[model samples]
Target: MKDTLLDLQDIQKSYDATPVLAGVSVTLSAGETLALTGESGSGKSTLLHLAGGLDQPDAGRVLLHGQDIGQMDDTARAEARRLHIGLIFQQFNLVPSLTVGSNIALQARLAGRHDAAFCTTLGHRLGLSDLTTRYPEQLSGGQQQRVAIARALAPKPALILADEPTGNLDEDTGDAVLSLLLDLVSETGAGLLMVTHSPRLAGRLSRRIHLSRGALAAA
Candidate 1:
């Protein structure tokens, strides 16, 4: 059996008495892809944040590779997160002053896992090879999103958490970006848990789960 890369057990979270997640449990194994789907107000993003160690659960454990990072100290948790999880977001948060190549290599360099050959391969695969010298302001929305994906993967993390990664792109562009992400993730055997509003996009993953009112509605 493949090793479980993420395990969220009975996860519960709240914001000023507003419960965002209630007894949520899920797992993502290495080389698997899981899509999270829900309405706008649902807790899909909250769950993703917890999984990525950006937030702690109120009443349960968030484990990465069987270690409960929520129990660690702040610095330890951050380091564990940096070493184990790669995050992609809707904003494509590339540094404004950095060129495409530097943006793609940023995360890997921080994690002390920079690999020039791998980064080059990722840039080529994501169609950013020729755009490496350009700054973020010079690229289109789809190109910026591709840069985000390459940055996240450069560290070779065991788990990937993507929150509306292609949300800013048009339908066709979103589909193409998602395909590239899935293809590279599959090739690297990294577990992917992505939040997506489009059912069509969610259906492409190996597994799907739906959240409603802070709890899982379907799995």
Candidate 2:
């Protein structure tokens, strides 16, 4: 059997008196792509954050590669996330001062996994090769998102967590970017857990889960 890249067991989280996720359990196997779809305020991003070790659940366990993230201290969790997980956000969280190439290589360099040739090739694949010398501000929304994708995949992480990564782009651009992302993820054999509101996009993945009122259901 293939090893599970990510597992969330009976997760519960709340902000003050308001609940976000409740009894949410999910699992992703190696190289599988899972799409999480739900309406806004459905706790989709909350689940992704806990799975990536960026946030802790009030109750339950988050495991990555059979290791319990909830058992690790803050520093340990940070290290685990940095070394094993790739994150993509709708905001295109790139360093404004860094050129496109530097931004693409940032996470890989931090993980001590930077490969200049691989990053260069990724830039080309994402259609950002010509923009390598420019800063994030100089690129269009789609270009910036491509750089973000390059940064996330450059490290060759075992799991990729994305929160509406293409939400900021137009329909056409978002579709193109999604295609490139899926192709590259397959090439790298990484497990992808993505949150999106688009049913069309969700159907593109291998499996789909829906979150409703802090509970998970099969889509």
Candidate 3:
């Protein structure tokens, strides 16, 4: 294992006192690709939410690199997600009003880290070069997902979190997209913690762990 980039120590989350996660913990290493597998409602999403700094754990701590994410306020957490973490979701969630190009560049512009060359390279690699001027509504499901992925990768984040990134696509399209995503992730050497239900997809990762009834165990 490499140096730990993200760490969850005794993480616990509850919704209306229904425990979603109980004593969940893991140390995500740099350049590692970890697959999180589980049935529905197994607290996989909750773990991702907490690890990505998208939500707070009711109890315990989250560390990004060496900084305690649980220690940061909302504003700091948002910044953490922006500058250091890349997140992909089941839904593409592109801004309907913005062009694909603009959506891809949005984060970089806000962080004042816009590198035109890098963005262009990402777009080309993601098969979005021709679709750059088009809006999300104009693209197909696969294209939209690709755009979302490009947006996430544009920032060159240290860590990436993907929640069923290929769930909405057909098998072929999903494979292609996943291929692009893994290739890009490998190139950047960013640690990846992906939530997936597909055994085929999970098999490609460096490590595999399954969640059952809110508990994670290596498979």
What C-alpha lDDT does candidate 3 achieve relative to the native structure? Answer: 0.88
lDDT string for model 1 (1-219, tens) is: 999889999999999999999999999999999999999879999999889888888989988989998778889888987898899987788999999999999999999999999999889877899999999999998899889989998999989999998887778767877887788777889899999988889999999999999999964
CA lDDT, every model vs. true structure = 0.90, 0.90, 0.88
**For model 3, what is the alpha-carbon lDDT of residue 107?**
77
Worst 10 contiguous positions by lDDT, candidate 3: 176-185
For candidate 3, write residues 1-219 as lDDT tens digits: 578899999999999989999999888898888899999999999999899898898989999989988878999999999889889987787899999999999877776789889999989877789998999999988888888888888888889899998887788877887787678668877899999999999998888989888888655
lDDT (10s digit) by residue, model 2, range 48-108 = 9899898889999999999999879999999998899999987788999999999999999
> Residue 179 of model 2: what lDDT?
84
Residue 83, candidate 1: Cα error in Å is 1.1
Query: Between 2 and 3, whose TM-score is larger?
Result: 2
Off by over 4 Å in 2: none
